[model samples]
Target: MTADSILNVRWRKASASDPFDNCVEVARLEDGEVGVRNSRFPSGPALVFTRDEMVAFIDGVKKGEFDGMTV
Candidate 1:
């Protein structure tokens, strides 16, 4: 869905996020896909991912595959 379409959905951020809300928020869309957006840009664009794609990304994260990209 487009960013404007999912604006009313409930979004949540990880518990690890700082109090400043500088993090990505995620939500389960009605269509069963996962929606992701930057907490700092709530009205901006969002990315929608299928369940499998989201699972693979989370798995890669757990394996530290994207560690090098972070600070």
Candidate 2:
């Protein structure tokens, strides 16, 4: 399905290490892809990734691909 198709989909947060709550939520698409958006910006723009891209991104996270990278 496309992003518009999943526009009304519900999302769940991954997890939170701090009790204060600064985390992101993810929505799993029916087409095997995924959508990620800031938990605070529920209605804002989201990034869509294919299953393989998501997996690779997760792997990169595990390997610190964003190490020292600041937003």
Candidate 3:
């Protein structure tokens, strides 16, 4: 999946989303890919992740794996 296919996607902010000091925005692409990019830079490059990868990352956040905490 490519950003071109994601352009028309209805982007929704994550329920637990926080404002981006770096102007970042995330959207779920139609092809089940996740698109992350800097809102400040509309034409900026985006990082794409598969649905499973995104879910794993979210699970890690909920478990605080990066903060030295396990839930």
Candidate 4:
């Protein structure tokens, strides 16, 4: 969905986010897809991902599948 389209949606940030609000926000769209955008850029471009794709990504995160890149 376009960035403007989700402007009114309820976006949420991770519970662990710092007080400075430096984190991404996420929300579930009407079409069941997930919306993700940078908290620092509320009106910037957003990326839409399917449920399954998000699940896979989340699982990978839990398993630290992308840890190699961070090291």
Task: Give the runs in model 4 whose Cα sits over 4 Å from its true position.
Answer: 69-71
Cα displacement (angstroms), candidate 4, residue 44, comes to 0.8
Model 2, residue 64: C-alpha shift (Å)? 1.7
Residue 30 shift from truth in candidate 3, angstroms: 1.3
Candidate 1: tens digits of C-alpha lDDT, residues 1-71: 45667845789899999988799999988988999998888778899999999999999999999999978
- Clashes found in each candidate (C-alpha, N, C closer than 3 A): 0, 0, 0, 0
Cand. 4 TM to true fold: 0.84
Per-residue accuracy of model 3 over 18-53 as CA lDDT, tens digit each: 565345567887788889776656566778989999
Cα lDDT tens digits for candidate 2, 30-59 = 777888876655666778889999899899
Clash pairs, model 4 backbone: none
Question: Arrange candidates by lDDT, highest first: which order?
Answer: 1, 4, 2, 3
Pairing residues by index, what is the TM-score of model 3?
0.66
Best by TM-score: 1
TM-score of each: 0.87, 0.71, 0.66, 0.84
**Candidate 1 accuracy as lDDT:** 0.88
Clashes of 2: 0
The residue-by-residue lDDT of candidate 4 on 45-66, one tens digit each, is 8999999999999999999998
Instruction: Pick the winner on lDDT between candidates 1 and 3.
Output: 1
Regions of candidate 1 where Cα sits further than 4 Å from its true position? none
Clashes of 4: 0
Model 1 lowest lDDT segment of ten: 1-10
